[model samples]
Target: MTPIRIRIGRGGRGRLSARILVSQLAILALTGVIGFALFAFAQRSALDRTYEERAVAIAKTTAADPQIRRAMQDGGGAVVQAVAERIRQSSGASYVVVIDLHGVRHSHPMPQLVGSPVAEPIVARDGQPHVGTDQGATGRSANGRVPLYGPTGELVGEVSVGIPERDVLGELWHELLTFAVYAAIATALGAAAAFLLARRLKRTTFGLELEEIAGLLQDREAMLHGIREGVLAFAPDGRISVVNDEARRLIGLGTALGSTLDEVLPDGRLRRALDGTLTGTDISVLTDEHCLVVNRMPVTLHGRALGAVVTVRDRTELVGLLRELDSVRGLTDALRAQQHEFTNRMHTLAGLLDIGAYDDAYDLAVESAGAGQALTEFVRGRIGNPLMVGLVVAKTTVAAERGVWVELADDSALGADPPQLRLLLTIVGNLLDNAIDAAGDGPPPADGRTVRLALTEDERGTTVRVADTGPGIPPGARESIFEDGWSTRPDRGTARRGLGLALVHRLVSRHGGTITVSEGPGAVFTVRLPAPAVRPKNRFAEALPVGGDRR
Candidate 1:
């Protein structure tokens, strides 16, 4: 797999990037607005000052001139026109008008105002600088108020000049436009840099996260594949996420991901087992044909549950071997019985021959020989597996003598794959022996204390139920029944050993079956086995070999 690379500036990271960028842009815009206002104010103030100074200079020059005084006194109304004309000829003057002290316009920028009474009077009758009164039509129409004074500083006719408002606003507007253009360029550049930086940071973080996840997945896969036990993991939604190879083979699934347990096993013990396990119930199931032990626990992080992981181990072959061992133990008991019987016969024959009753001794010897032949035939009829048949037959006789009934419920109907069948019988034998031991040496319990065996198979597959009527297993001990060294029988001793049920569990898994023991009128053990949907031509051999190493 190619490793993910951490590239910078591939995609944007967080909202803060845009937010901060916009905030800075807004600040820039606001600053630009404030600066524009200040610049406009300064330009307007300077223009007003220049216009006022020019007007003042022209008025003083005209007033101080003897020619302008002579002209106004002698030339009469023509004096104002001649002064206006000379002022208009001066620099930076657009329009000029002059009025006489008598409140009559003399020279108007518009020729029509030349003969009119000023229409706006500037000087009062006393002519004391008009004593702070507004004089109408004495000043220019466009610019603001202009107060006039004669050469002697007393109020005279007012003179005003009009300055175009556009000059000041035009300069301010030009400066504002330049600022706006610069701000826009700066904003664009800043935004682009922010986006690029955010994208780079985002990509780097995402790449790191992906690398970590990939490593975790690889580790999980190794753990699943390398472990001997089958492992299954699922999400809270009941979707199977991970199934080890061992688990796949055990549950007969080609693939587990994206599939639920219901989809994998359909409606079977494996599915049931998983359901129970996920719900925090640990279960052990055993029957005439199979034994399975399942444990489920929720995977959690910081006290929160992520999902559940189930560990399934098949104990079919293990159970079968344990039962086979029990059968051998039974045979030893039979041999011991036979030795005791033979010793008694030898004593009797010796006693009779010593008493000189030779004919009677001959008849006694024939009777002993006949009894041995019948015992051999009874054992041969009951034992199943060829390798261990002799041992089991002997054991059956021992169980019967102890008041425990050993019954076969048509094991051939189990329909387990041929190799699995062999393993099944062995597991059943152990369960039967355990039940027999629990029954003890007394009249059976009022409930008959009998061990019941039932095996049936059909299109849905095989089910074996071996329930015992002996005092039902203790509730607390039921789940632990298959655990190694969990025997309730103290009398069986180490000679019988506690490996029986543990081995039973091992064999159950070898054949991909489930074992569950429940409380009933007595103890009921149910085993369900689903035939491998894709049965290999050498299914049994492929799964496990006879007398092979078993763990």
Candidate 2:
């Protein structure tokens, strides 16, 4: 493969070639347009000159003829008609007429026009020919015109010569068709040549098997450069090999080539990754701080380890975020626990009252009730099991305090170690919150007002259902409610009310799930999630200290 003329510039090889090709096309198009325009102009000008010369010569001869002048003055219709007919036959004029200075018709190509007046003037020069062109008269065959006057410069009936526009128009049409054929052939040839050139250029310069494969490698390299992961390569001897920009930045080095793993990585997770790759197993090992996830794989050929590659991903910020999320989860659990205790204490007071311990029971009940928001307190306690139970309990307590009853029917078969529980809690919590808010600022839903929640898990996955007995979601508000900032309670305090459902939708989608709303006098939300066929190692448990139990 021969290297083409190499130019040094910011415009690299491929880009420079494209610029050259475009420049060529631009020149070709401009030349073609200018040349075609000039050709049409010249052709039309030549045709017009030839027609004018022929008309002028014929007019000059007819005007100077002696016999024609006497015949026009004394001969009336018979003589003038003969002259007009002779001119029509000889010159191929379509129509001719002769009239005196009074404009009365003396001779006519048609007999009816002999007595009529010549409405048009016999335009000509002194001692020259009247050769003004006009359209042919009456129902003549031709479309063009040429008029002549007599030797006395009197108004001899005009002789109009008509010619069809087809003669010049046909040539122009032919030329246009030819240009189109040329353009089509040029475009097809250019496209085919471009394809062939691109293939040849890629193979010669890049050593790539195919143009598409070269393009793929180019895209992959770009993606690797764009990412923030610190990627490094090893030559199976644990020596530092190829290091990308990100890896160099993380290691704080100018160049990483030819150095051992110990020199480059030092006492960090990068050293552990090099050690892991030497074992020849594809594995992702997390660092002590749980901040980095490193994947090591051996690049081999014929069962021989040619080299190994390690992709270092910084998960420091991600770990911090997960810790924050866990704190939120803890708060949810505490809330559920409080709800359970409240419910038990309330049951004890009711039992005492039923036994007829009037004064004692009444006093005990009033003390226990204590004007505090017990329902709210209780709902916050039961945060485990079928995930929706905790959310439903919280929702019910909130509604009851606000004078609305919430009935929850959940069919979550989630064991204590269900993977989907956390996701379930997020979804149900959002839907119930929306339903409670939609119940309005009024006295909840009249008498039977309630928020209903149900969760069902099956072979497919999990499905959550939440509905409110309030005025139901408005037809128009139903669709927009899931939009990020859409809120039915626009006046509700500084705390955001709308982001809950939007976040719920995003989380569900991230898990490869779908959520939909059912229309009604009240809003109903349903969510479905596809269960992972294979369980993942519990990273939360793994994060615990050596002997610590997350359970």
Candidate 3:
């Protein structure tokens, strides 16, 4: 498998808080300015419309007065001026003028300007009325004009009332100031909201800049995949959160990073452990040919359970190495025992020779040679495979050390493939060890405290029978004997005492093998390992890909 590489990014990066604060404040202020401007424009339009409409109403009402129309028909005089001035003053109009249909003003704000033609001819056009801004005798004003007619329906005069542009602007400016105050208050409130928002964002980001956050994400990806051990984490609701490449291969999962834990593990025990419903340390589990030791821990923050993280350690190869080590250790001890025994006899022969007993020394030497030859023949005649032979020899000496006798009654030539050889060693080694323990102390201490092994292999595969003469298994206790953490009897201060039988069961079931026991004068266990074709797996296998993609 290819290794993941790490990457470095720029250090001492700036914080994003200041930038965000400035941005938000600017946006809110801009919105306020635009909003106020639109308000002012629309208000000005409405106010001007109101001003024009008011002037038109006043001018039309004054023109419709019977006294004003009668005076206009009598030609310009003081009565006309008096009525026009009174109407203009009371109506808050800038100027109220009476004009003849010929466009000559009959009465005006300035009497001097009376009897003069109006400035805009549209206002004086025959039988026409107009509302607009125009330069009057005094100044530019929004003017509204209305024509008066005699009872005969003939146009005789026109009334013009003006609202000065200066007055209209003054009123608009005052209203705009009030509106601006309200807009300012609203803008201030928005700015306050933006300030709080920026602070919350800064806290959530933990003062990291955008680039720094991106860099951290990249580093997380590299770190998760770079480790050799498997790591898998789940969310509070059981959905898979993080899964590394090694985890996928160890769990035999296929592209399961986002799936729920149950979907990938398919083991209820494992799920319970992940969700904190079950908890244990260094729990052993079997998956295919691999033996995994899982350690699970809850992910918590301030006493709240977030989820769990499970670390998987592959112990398959380690176990095989341990078995090989046991074989080696056993052979070493056997050789040491033989060396000690032979040395004692040689010394006895030497002393006898020193004492001039040639006959006795000769016999002793012959006996020693015979004993060594018998030991060699015994190993070669029963077990042909060197590794298994070493194991049996070691077990024999070990059992002897504990005052129990161990024997390999029969063993066929185990010329099997490497896969079958590993299976053979694991199953037989565990059973033999268990048998020796069950046999307890040897002969005379107990009537028949002996452990025996029988093995035979054919096209259908190998069968093994182990019988021990110690206290045999009790009735109805075989059912759960192979269950994990279920020991026949508890060892002092030890909880996982009977993992051997459990492991044996796993290997047997994995390889389509059958194992059964019977209670008698002694306990006898018979196991039948299926042919190599039934289950073949090389002990030395390479790592799989990120997912379970065989391709």
Candidate 4:
């Protein structure tokens, strides 16, 4: 045999963890790049300011020096250049220049530019210092200017100091390298977090992809509602988790999800069966309008208890058919008994004729015919329904064959057909059958082996009582006698036992009736079915009568 293979569809995208890591890293990288650019711009601006402040401080010191002021007063020449260059070398500035009031440079970084006219006007002639970035002869630098003074505080010229832009850039690069290392670490940590998050999600989803989960959900719903059997899934806490359409129809629970069993079901055998208090397979539970066979199995995954699933199948129609079959079997037994009686009479007649006793043979035949006719007429006169009368006659005949007397009680009176004849028949038939079996078992009763049936009809409803002269029911078993699958009889293996009383109970309860069992010298079962508020059409009225003759 070839092995069956099942396949599940997965998403076309890559694994969840890898995708998360890549996406997170991309986002982190983008954010880091933007951050680094902003940091570099801000750092460069701040470095320029710092260099400009340092240059202003250096120019102020040089302009305040007595020697530089004295030399400028003496008409700036080599002495002034020497003092400026010394300050430049010590302060690490790019250039220092002293120019006279006529906009002529007295000192410059290039020796040839000394004693040459400056390009700009005397900006520091007011004796205030000025600092800013300027493109000088050497390169772009942060420059500062202060007015130089001669002896007696007389303004002679101005001193200018500059710091190169390259120095500021060099410091910024070092800081940026350190910041890049931090950004890399941050990106790595974000990637690790993304991978861990993806792993957690994978475990939560049971390793199924999004597409596979959606597919399984669709399949679950289709199968759940499509099947004929009712399905109910309960959570571990005993609340209804999933209830299909069939389950709602079967149990009369409309939109009962999230409700506990006790909230929906009454305290009865049906509740017991569903709640698992009555534990068994294919347990029969009778409701007000339906007979159900329910099976429950606990669901577990990987040694953990999930809950239970209950499946229900409607057996109402099947049970009715089975009862009808029992009725036919009873009639067949009656016919066989009648045939045996006829054969005995035939043999007797032949013997009488062989001895030439024609008169005795004729009398024997008349007596047998009168006896059968009298029983039929009595049943027909007592019970107005032809169907019920036929059942009584057949059961009496069958009982006689087993040496058990079956009779209608003297007080039995049903002048008109009951409104619910079919239900009445089922109730009476099952009770009489059970009584017959009970009365026939063991030794004959002191009052004789007999099953007695009493029926009464009135405006209120119909009542039936069946009593048997057999071993009385024990007190302990009385309550369970009418329960499904509980039988006192020895297992016969030929047919299923213990359903007759259960079906009877269900029928009685369906019509808002009650049944009780009591014991005196033997067991007595009494059932009362109240009249319906509005009588329904009798569908079985047109059907052929049960227990018809086959021979």
lDDT order of candidates, top first: 4, 3, 1, 2
Give the TM-score (vs. native) of candidate 4.
0.68
RMSD, one per candidate, in order: 16.0, 25.2, 8.6, 7.5
Model 1 misplaced stretches (Cα beyond 4 Å): 1-212, 277-282, 285-291, 355-360, 375-396, 400-551
Q: Tell me the TM-score of each prediction against the true structure.
A: 0.42, 0.33, 0.62, 0.68
**Of the pair 3 and 4, which is ahead by lDDT?**
4
The lDDT of each candidate is 0.58, 0.56, 0.71, 0.80
Cα lDDT of model 4 overall? 0.80
lDDT of 2 by residue, 122-202 (tens): 443133333333444544232222333455656554433433345446655777678768876776676567656765664
- Across 371-451, the per-residue lDDT of candidate 3 in tens digits comes to 646765787676667666755666777667556777677554454333366567666777777777677632343455688
lDDT of 4 by residue, 9-48 (tens): 4454346556666777788889989999999999889998
Worst ten in a row by lDDT for model 2: 542-551
The all-Cα superposition gives candidate 2 an RMSD in Å to the true structure of 25.2
- In every candidate, how many clashes are there? 30, 16, 0, 0
**Angstrom error at residue 284, model 3:** 5.5
lDDT, residue 277, model 1: 38
Pick by lDDT: 2 or 4, better one: 4
